[model samples]
Target: MAEMKTLTAAARSGTGKGAARSVRREGRIPGVIYGGGDAPEPIALDYRELNKLIYAGHFLTTIFELEVDGAKQRVIPRDYQLDPVKDQPLHVDFLRLKAGATLRVDVPVHFINQETCPGIKKGGLLNIVRHSVEMRVPADAIPDAIVADLGKLEINESLHISAVPLPDGCKPTQRDRDFTIASIAPPIAAPEEPGAAAAAAAAGKGGKGAPAAKAAPAAKAAPKPKK
Candidate 1:
């Protein structure tokens, strides 16, 4: 298991959109921590630290140790809002967790060994249906990613969520029996003409061919008799 990252947070006394905007001006992100029968604590974090974790792409699955006023709290990111234009973290919601508690989280699915896939070698394309899967796991045992091996898969075949190997104590949260994760299919080919080229080639061979017999010419005397 990977180690959890620790971040510094401060309890905020103010609330509301204006207050949050003011906090952002000072390079802080406003957040809230709720769950586990405790009162929700409104907090603020340094923008630089939060940006680093967001950029790492592990904010959802990775456990975070939040230090609030010299007290340590274990939590996971539940929800967050991003600035539409700036693409920066606007606000975050953290759910407080306890040790040995079962938590549900979405884990990223990564495909491996595409170069060795027979389908891809035969001019087929790979399509991924689900990029991540939800699983129920202990808070401490959450996996970073679920790997799917595509080396043995042939064209039109797929691997489902149930077929993936889960880490110890982690199971898929999906209710269905089989959920497709990825598949490969044959590539489409362009259409070609068959008859026009043959006719053009035959015409270029020769203009003259065998001729048939002519008819008799006995009607020429009737015109002179009328005159």
Candidate 2:
């Protein structure tokens, strides 16, 4: 289950870029909350606090309960914009989540027991195809991450979406095919030994089709002057 976080915000009466700029000048981030069958509400959050949360990571997957002017709104962060240069939070969008609502979100995939994987023990490489998967999950039951266990995987073997255990009422977005999540690739070739490589090179140096060194010119006949 996703852990819920709480944020405090204040209603903002103004709208548009100028108003948003004014809010930012005052050290606040302007944002909006919509959906859940209600009119969108404009609000502002403390810049420092919001920045901290944004950088801390996993802001989108976790649910946030926004306390806006004494009314608490349960929402999930859907989108956000950042300054291209500084990477600072510029604007945010939150979707108000009502009870029983379902959300389609990308949940990160976490590989476990990799050190104990049989394939890895045998010098095989683990190739990940999908780092995360899109899931349609209930708002209250969104998983923090999906686990992919590699302990028993063997070389040339693969794990598919159907093998993973998902939260109740959660389903993968890709239902048409059982897609591969990861695979154990064949081991990389070991480097040739220096002595062996040298021996092979020497053998091939004069092998078939190789041009032979030109014979030394025949010694000139002894000068006939003495005769």
Clash totals in order = 0, 0
C-alpha lDDT (0 to 100) for residue 165 of candidate 1: 87
Task: Look at candidate 1 and tell me the lDDT of residue 224.
Answer: 57
Q: TM-scores for all candidates? A: 0.82, 0.87
Highest TM-score model number: 2
CA-lDDT, candidates in order: 0.88, 0.94
Where does candidate 2 stray beyond 4 Å? 190-227
Give lDDT tens digits, candidate 2, residues 1-227: 88999999999999999999999999999999999999999999999999999999889988999999999989999999999999999999999999999999999999999999999999999999999999999999889899999989999999999999887899998899999999999998989999898778877867544468999999988867864
Top lDDT: which candidate number? 2
Q: Where in model 1 is the C-alpha error above 4 Å?
A: 193-227
TM-score of 1: 0.82
